[model samples]
Target: MPVLVFIDQSEGQVKKASLEALTYGAKLAEQLGTHAEGVLLGKVTEDPSLLGKYGVKKIHHVDHDELTHLDSQVYTKVIAEVATSMGAKLIIFSNNADGKTIAPRLSVKLKAALVTGAIALPETGDGFMVRKNVFSGKAFANISLKTDIKIIALNPNAYKIVSGEGTAEVVSFAAQIESPKVKVTQTDKITGSVPLSEAERVVSAGRGLKGPENWGMIEELAEELNAALACSRPVADTNWRPHHEHVGQTGLAIAPNLYIAIGISGAIQHLAGVNRSKVIVVINKDAEAPFFKAADYGIVGDAFEIVPKLTAAIKNKKANG
Candidate 1:
């Protein structure tokens, strides 16, 4: 049986997380001595065959208008049917908002063992065991899946995307599309900003900046770095920043390549969401701040003084080059 990967898309474009999932799935399939295939729902503007570079041999496309919008129940039902028909023993999904919503439901429908937040490939020496993050990125847990059919949700940015020269054969899958229960009446899209979830670099701040008026420096730093802007939960609750910019245990989780924190206290709740960042740089005047302990590099100085200098240095380097 071939490994089947769920390719998640937004606005007819494949998500970065899904590319990571495809690479992971393709590697896993190679390990299992089987080929990797992808399943895409909805109409996409990009060529499905281009995903072959990520290692999938084929793509099963369900080109339906209803699938443009995510309906967890409908997605689960259709995917379960496809898996059953294709006899896919292993299924992979990107552990994002859509994957989180659909994977569990598909697991229940297919009666398969489901593992979420998988950070690494499975160890198949003895049995199928997958390593996943537990306790909000604080710890690792190895889960053993005994079922014949297994489902794994790869954490976003957990695996590197490997692409090579190839073209996948795209095939049309005739799935029974159903109407979505949830209706999206309006979409408030934030334009001209890097999406926090998919951002490679991020510059974030907290109440230490004092108020919304002080946000100009943070924005300037982020703009210079070409990174996303984020804030702590309190800043959002106080209405200093929009709630969507808030990142913590109760808010959106992110794992960027570079995370720069300014004036944030680094509470445990806040760390849970961003601790997976590869490199963390914390800037604060308070040397006793807890965030410094978790930071890869700590600057014990005022962000107001440090940020401008750092931004200027970056500008100078870019200008000279």
Candidate 2:
């Protein structure tokens, strides 16, 4: 049986997490002596065949208008059907919001052992043991799945996206469509801002900036770095930034390639969200700020003085280039 990857899309575009899932699934399939295939259900603008570069050999597309929006129940049903039809022994998903919802539901429907937040490839030498983060990114756990059909929801940014040659053969799969139980009355998009969850680099601030009026320097830094803007929970609660931009245990969790935190004293709750970042740079005047413990790089300085200089330096370098 082939390993099936769930391709998540937003606004007709495939999400970065989905690409990671595809690469992870394809590699897993190669280890298991099976082909890697992708299954997508939506009105996607990008051709699924283009995903072949990620190592997916085939793609099963169910282009239904109803699937354009997320309805967890509806998506789970369709994916379960696809898995059954294709005889997929393993299903892969990114441990994002959609995957968190649908993977459990699909596991219940298919009676498969499900593992979420997988950080590494399964250890097939002994059994199907997958490594994952636990205790809110504080520790690692190796879980064993002893079911015929297995489901893995990989953590975002946990695995590298390995792309190579070839074009995936796109196959059409007609599935029984169902009406969505939930209704999306309105959609409000944050214009011109990169989604924090999908950002490669991020610049975040906290209460130390004083107020929203002083956010220009932070924004400029983010723009210079081509990074997403984020804020600590207190900043969002105080209306210094949008709640969506908040990164903490109670807010949006991000694992960007580079996480630059300005003025924020990283509390344990806040670190729970961004500690997964590949490289963390913390800038705060207080030398004893707790965030420094987790930061790969730390600068003891005032944000008001340090941020502008950093932004200008980056701009000058780009201009020279």
Candidate 3:
């Protein structure tokens, strides 16, 4: 049996989270003394052959134009077909938006043991056991998968994506395609800048920045670090920043390696989204700001004064090097 990883794509391109899933699947395949493969639903612009470097021996593509847009029901049926056909003992998905929607349904359809929000690889000594987060990132629970088939939805940024010299052979998988039951009339796209979900490092601001005019400082620091920019719910609600930059419970959940929050007093809702970040740096003038309690590093200073210095330090280091 082989491990099949579902590669999530958008606008004909694969998401960064898919690479992480590929890496995880590859390593797991090696551990199981088997090989890893990938499953793609629609036509992707990039060459799937290049993805072999991440450890996928082959890529199974459905290439149905009808799959241009994601539908949970249709995609689940197709993925289950691919998995069952390949006799996939283990399957992987990025626990992002698409994975969140389809994983549960897939578990029911395939009768496979499923684990969502998995933080680590499976421990398969006695049986298949996966570790996942619980209690809103406050605790961890080890779950055992009892089915003959296992499915894991990995949390983004939890695993480092490492690629080496290799290329996956592209293969065609013939599966009956069905029209999406869901209709899409129009699409509203977010414009400009790096996407927060794809970003490895992110610098976010909040209402404490006062107004839109002062946001240049935060953006400057973000630019120096080549990081994605984000804002708290309040900033987006007030139109200080676009809704796309919002990162909180009501907005996008991100798991960047380094999350720098400036001027944001952390609310439980906000922390719920970013608590998975490997490193969190909080910068606020208030010494009692709640965000500092959860921060890996903290700076108690005015954003106006501290940000410029931080930017200069990063720039100065680059210059000296």
Best candidate, TM-score-wise?
Answer: 1
Report lDDT per candidate: 0.93, 0.92, 0.91
- Residues 127-216 of candidate 3 have per-residue lDDT tens digits of 889999886676799999999988999998889999999999999999888889986677666666677887889999998899999988
**Candidates sorted by lDDT, best first:** 1, 2, 3
Ranking by TM-score: 1, 2, 3
Residue 198 alpha-carbon offset, candidate 3, angstroms: 2.2
Q: Which regions of candidate 3 deviate over 4 angstroms?
A: none
Model 1 CA lDDT for position 103: 97
My TM-score estimates for the predictions, one after another, are 0.97, 0.97, 0.95
lDDT of 2 at 26: 93
Q: Which ten residues in a row have the lowest lDDT in candidate 2?
A: 182-191
lDDT of 2 by residue, 1-321 (tens): 999999999888899999999999999998999999999988788778999999999999989988988898899989999999989999999999889989999999999999999998899887899999887788899999999999999999888898899999998899888999977678787889888888999999999999899999898999999999999999999887889999989998788999999999999999998988999999999999999999999889888889999999999999997
TM-score of 1: 0.97
